[model samples]
Target: MEFTQPVDSNLFDDAKVVGKPMQRIDGPLKVTGTAPYAYERNDAAPDALYGYPLGAAIGHGRITRMDAEAARSAPGVRAVVTTLEIDPLEKGINNVARLFGGAEVQHYHQAIAVVVADTFEQARAASALIEVDYEEGTPADLDLDAAFERVQGTGEPDTLVGDVEAAFRDAPHVIDQMYHTPAESHTMMEPHASTVDWSDGEEMTVWTSNQMINVNLKSIAATFGIDRERIRVESPYVGGGFGSKLWLRADAVLAALGSRAAGVPVKLALPRPMVMNNTTHRSATVQRIRLAAREDGHLTGIWHEAAAYCLPGGRGENPTAQTPIFYAGETRRVKNHVVDMPLPETADMRAPGEASGLMALEIAMDEMAEALDMDPVQFRIINDTQVDPANPDIPFSDRHFVECLERGAEAFGWSKRNTTPGEQRDGDWLIGHGVAGAYRGALVLPSGARAILDGGKLIIETDMTDIGTGSYTILAQTAAETMGMDVADVEMRLANSAFPASSGSGGQFGAPSSASGVYAACMALRDKIAGNLGIEEASFNGGRVTGGGTDMALSEINEEVSAEDAIQWGDFQKDYAMGTFGAHFVEVGVHAYTGETRVRRMLAVCDAGRIINPVTARSQVIGGMVMGVGAALSEDMALDRGRGFFANHDMANYEVAVHADIPEQEVIFLDTLDGVATPLKAKGVGELGLCGVAAAIANGLYNATGIRVRDYPLTMDKFIDRLPAV
Candidate 1:
């Protein structure tokens, strides 16, 4: 479809700032240690005091007895606030577990006490000294195999269409398998942190690192029984947050509470170790997938069931977000289930449902491809659905998934792949090529933004957090492109409570949803300028901000217009469905002797409409691909069932991909203009990168080996016994 003003098209097609790979705007500050992360902002803000949290040592248990004498008398200790001592702290909508001062032990390291101190070091040293006796309640068996026995019904228990059971029963060929994935960690460069200095006892200001700031502001106020209007939270720079920092985590709340108690502002940062247990972690899962197909290679039926662990208090929900709905199946039901384990609050991670689900589904597809004696790419091509079979009325906004699969296949030379595993041996290494198509909807939520035109400059402010995704640069490019000016002409002030509430940077919505807000506001400014020049708003249309019969500086328009005088838009999402698509191709070499696997190369063809900044978007996809590789190969947070805590609780044991682990990576964006998604005709490119990625790599590993392994991390240990004999 055509757009009134081709959304974000200039970014990909223009020579100014769109396609050109430029250095990041914040690169210098980051390299020189000039940028201030959350914990470091205390120096400039209304500085606060220091508070350190006292964690529950056991994973599941009640605090039977507590001793605070040593901690209270410790040097510089201001106040020792334990669970029973403080006033009730309300629950944050974004937070499933309470921030602090809670008696009931729901999960591991649930904060039961906070030691307020004059100095951070004192709080730290004293927090370690506090001792408590635990009832040592029996923790839930954390093993997935044992837990799924009583999984009962899948999540959202009953959603049915065609009879999957009868269809699979009548099918000519069937493949049923179970896949398991351990929980993983984010390990972002910075830990969870917050600095708080109250505006007054009833009010507070926190310098924090969280993806959603304004939402947290209200939640924090509600937690303390104060006015949301009284809180001012700001986070101009964030090191990185894959998904862990999305909500109002403990660091932000405990610090505020501690600061209130100390009567001086307080700063609290979760020590890297404490952050993992004190907050949340991705839950471990047990998944079982059953696929049935006809002799002609048509899928007759499919079933996906996934189970994950959570605290006894919280219900386990669907872990299978994206099942095989991408393909056309007459009878299919993808279900999710949660098992109660003595685990911490389980929440979202990047590419949540697709990430883990794909691990099993895609690999099974590879196995089915082998059973049918068909090319993996061709198998995907036949199953492509333009209109959702499950919900046939909703057509995709723009589906280039077929194009992605075909282009990716041609680019990766899939035809050259070795059909037989262990036969195409490169001396000691076996080479394999595999592909998996990615599907993720580009969602657009109502977003509002206000631009300030001050002194020949446009200061664009939104409550969106960058989260190391280069959001600021892309947003600036969108505004500058709309205003017909240089990117440098735009200044950004984002992730602050002072700004209007925004869609707050989750679900890969920043570039698409947030930039659309900026685009709307800029259009308003253009109209204001046109009116000032006596040109009818509609008269000065195409490529014309100020042209024939119109000449006026933007400064005059801002002077005459009030903030509310600016334009606002009505609901525009009804016209079309906006989404992003991509296909991931992975190459891997599994060692024949040692069963070691290393991802040799990877590529992704993405369609996220117009890439606002190619460099940043490429970085996002490549990073996501690497993360996908990690998920398929070597990333899982192991929980010590006996100890009732995470076994690899720290970075030393937790594995995330490093540069050394990655090979040459590539990403291609299908340039398109989608007005239905937004005025920018752009969609989110940040997240779709990892979606269906682990599946591709896992499928690739299977292609390299006849044995189809479904579980995640595709660990060699799991395959060593099944390896083919030379």
Candidate 2:
């Protein structure tokens, strides 16, 4: 089914399950501790040996010597494989550093060796016995500030829409500032783990914790120099994957290599410290924003330049991506500069570019509103654009950003907020209110699914991963709604390469794209059922086909029917600039004496088209809100510049927002349906809930103490010295 035009009506229009607040069907298994994570999949490979990975000692260098004789003789140790024994492996797609093989180290914690043993403890203990010596290279380039300075006079900007400098010079109200967001870890509950079976030299099967199965299957086939069909990747249950597990990582590769070498299945799970330093992280960004506005709080031009560090030949963090189309501006300039730093690999996490970008851009918006002495929410509304600012001829398919702002302001009691800082005090606390607009472009991908109706049960099979976002529930709901059956009667088999390919749960495109695929497959099944009944057209309802004077139960057909189809989008994005928009309102209290900040309450109003399941959607929004709080006031990966590694690489040293740190959070979704988005008429809300939340908290901090700090993770020290007098 090629989606080219807007859908006027569909089976989802009168949906009974798709739009309802349905509990997760997999919740019972998860809470009962029966759902198997990758590391605990003993049933799949009961005789699997354990493998422990050894990382490089130096940040960047070549190994001079490796003495693994001791580890090879260790008790229960089966085999020890080192990088020096083999040539460098081919790099996978989107991988900046090789997973294994060769002596040269591109970054700290690069996998260099694997020790296989009878037990996990035995393998881990044996790995410590190995000795390695490295010829350390010169200190790596780990500083973002120096990189920013180096790119200042290099060349023309990456993107230049119009005369931004002239617009800034001629504008009456203008603001220029710089902001910094430090590196952050995904901190997902489950670590990177995999279990590989290669006992049969002809075929290999891997049960891993990953977000994308097909992508990993292809990567594994490429890394092993095998046919794509010879490898199978399965991830039935993933505890959580913000974006870290989107690609094939070291654990799977190490396990596969160890299994092949030892002639037995092998299981490997990266240690907590290794998960921090070895895997991908959200790169730190230094962003400079210059906003030119009119006296009426309307934006005239936006100049956003961002600099981030990455391995050579890797795409860096893009903190200026959202500046071009977010608000109304005649002239806009957005640019990104990448610095070749030999640090850990930096890649997508949660919202990725928009998360860091909005952390600075929205704060700048608040500052601009102050310059104009206008309400921040009103200022945003004044600059809302229905059409893309870069290309005004193309309008958004659907946008309700203004409604989000107005409704959020009203619900959050914006009128009660005190205009002046330090005046509205609660004894030892100073109160403040802040608001910021949220933005994330809607995305879709080609997805396919297969539906089988057998024994009065509808089964949908796809390679989509849940990742704790309720993909299973939504897909079942879609299948049930399309086939006129109860959700309980539908079975979902997901995250297996044997199933049809799906969107694979990333970039906020999983729900709509995968659900559309299921819808298409069920529509195919509906047509087949109708044709078999000898009806030109039929209305399916209550498990009966009613049309052409024929009314019969689906179960009475006596023959098993199956159909497979996919949803392929056709040039829709080219004609329409579609995005999800929201508004975040936060209330904060600052301790006047200690200068500590505490959030009082928070509210998010979102407009992301039709929500498939409000229950899971709410959970996703609140989870994003918690992560946003962590990004605002707590989470930061401390870097050891001289060593080129994350110094605080464990949970003890790293900090995240806890339950006590979060207050009351309310999420409101606007009643909206985007016909052009999909036949399901739904967009994603997972990333939108996080986009501008950190900036809202930053604005609240400023409103509380009258001190503006551009640096993120707003620790108390940043404003303690300048706090108002007690």
Candidate 3:
């Protein structure tokens, strides 16, 4: 099904199941602790041996000697495989650092060996016996400031548009500042885990916790130098994945090798510390933003220069791509650069670029508003652009940014906020209110699905993953609404490579793309049913078909009907600018003596097209809001510059947002639909809920305290000394 034309008056226009606040159908299993996660999948590979991985001690070095004889001779030990025993494996195209079978250590915690034993405890205890010797290399480039200067001096900017220099020079008002955000770990509930069974000769099955099934299968085949058809990956349930499990990790590869060597199935789960340095993280960034505007807060030129440290041949954080698409400006300059560093691989996390970039850009918007004596929300509304600012010929498919801001401001009582900083006090605390705008581009991918109708029950199969985002519920809704049946009659089977390929769950495209594919498949099945009943045109209702005054039950003539189809996109994506927009309002109270900030209230207004299921959509936005609070106040992967690794690797030291830290949170979704987005007229809100949340909190803190801290994770030490006198 080619999606080239805008859909008019489809079944979704009067949807019965979709767009409703339906409780997640998988909720009972999750709450009852019966959901089978990757590591707990005993049904997939029974009697699987436990495999424990050994990481390198040095940051950057070559392994000269590895003695695993002790570990091999330990109790219940099945086999021991070390990197020194085998030639280097093929580097996967999706992996920046090699997963296994490598001598040269690129970063700290690079997997060096795997110890397989009959029991997990035995495997873990035996893995500690392995000894390794390494020769260290030169120190890594861990300083972002030094790297930024080097790039500024040597390399050309990544993007340059209209004459920003002239616009800045002739502007009536200007604001320039540099902001820093430290690296952040995903810290999802689920660890990177996998179970591999190779008992069937030359054929392997891996049950892993990964976001993308097709991509993971390909990576596994490429890493082990096996045919792609020889491997099958299944992850029916994932505890959580904030873009950390988008690709294959060392756990899967190590488990496969261990199972092959031991002649039995093997399961491996990375320890918490290993999960930090061995896997991908959100790279720290140094961003310099210069905003020039007229006296009335009309933006003249926008300059955004961003740099982040990354490994050689790796793409780091792209925090400046949204500058041109976000606001209206005649002259704009956006530059992004990466400095080569011997650091752990840094990749996507949640919203990725926009999540990190808006932590600075939206705060800069607040500062510019202060300089012009204009309201922050009003300033954003004034700069809203319906078309692409860089290329004005293309208009947005559907944008409700101004409405989002207006409604959010009204709900949050923006008029009641004190315009002057440090002027509102509640008892011994200073009360302040803040707001920030949100933006995330809408994206789609070709996705396929298979629909099966057996005895009146509809079954939908796809490789789409839930990732704790309620993909199963919404997909069921789509099928039920399309077939004119209750949602309870629809069954969703997902997260298996054997199923039809889907867009997978990442980059906020999973819901829209996968749902559209299911819709296409359901439509095909409808055609088949109508044609079988000898009806020229059919009105499907109440599980029955009627046309030409003849009515018949749909299940009566069903001879095991099945249909498979995919939703392929056309050039309409390039013809219009598509994105999701939202607004965040935050209220905070700062202690007068300790400068401790506490969130008092929070509200988010989003306009991301039609909501699939409001219950699950609200949950996703609330989770993102909690993560944003952590990013603003506590989340930081402290880097050990001398050792080239994250110092606070454990959860004890690396603090996240808890229930006590969060206050009241409210989310409102504006009813809307995008004709160019999909047949469902829906977009993704998983990442849009988080885009500008941190900036709103930061701005609220600045309003509570006169001191402005340019750095992130606004700790008390950054502003304690400058607290207002009682």
lDDT of 3 at 166: 97
Per-residue lDDT over 1-726 for candidate 2, one digit per residue giving the tens place of the 0 to 100 score: 899898889888888888999999899999999999998888989999999999987889889999999999999998898989888887777788888998899999999999999998999999999899999998876779888877854667766778888999999998999899999999999999999998666699999999999889888888878998888899999989899999989999999888888889999999988898899999999988999998878888898888998888887688887888899988988888988988889988998899999999999999999999998989999999999988889999999999999999899999889789667789899888889899998999999999998878888999999999999998999998998888888999999999999989999999999999999889989999889888898887777778898998877778899999999998866799989999999999989988888999999999999999999999999999999999999899999899899988888888988989999999999959999998999998889988999999999988888989889899998989999887
Task: Give the Å shift of residue 24 in candidate 3.
Answer: 0.6
Worst 10 residues of 1 by lDDT: 560-569
Q: Put down candidate 3 lDDT per residue, 101-195, tens digits, no spaces.
A: 75899989999999999999999999999999999988776889887877753456565668899999999999999999889999999999999
Better of 1 and 3 by TM-score: 3
| Prediction-by-prediction clash tally | 8, 0, 0
**Native-referenced Cα lDDT, model 1:** 0.75
Better of 1 and 2 by TM-score: 2
TM-scores of the models, in the order given: 0.93, 0.99, 0.99
Question: Worst 10-residue stretch by lDDT in candidate 3?
Answer: 152-161
* Residue pairs clashing, model 3: none
Model 1, TM vs. native: 0.93
lDDT of 3: 0.90
After superposition of all CA atoms, the RMSD between model 3 and the true structure is 1.1
lDDT of 2 at 340: 90
Off by over 4 Å in 3: 153-156
Full candidate order by lDDT, most accurate first: 2, 3, 1
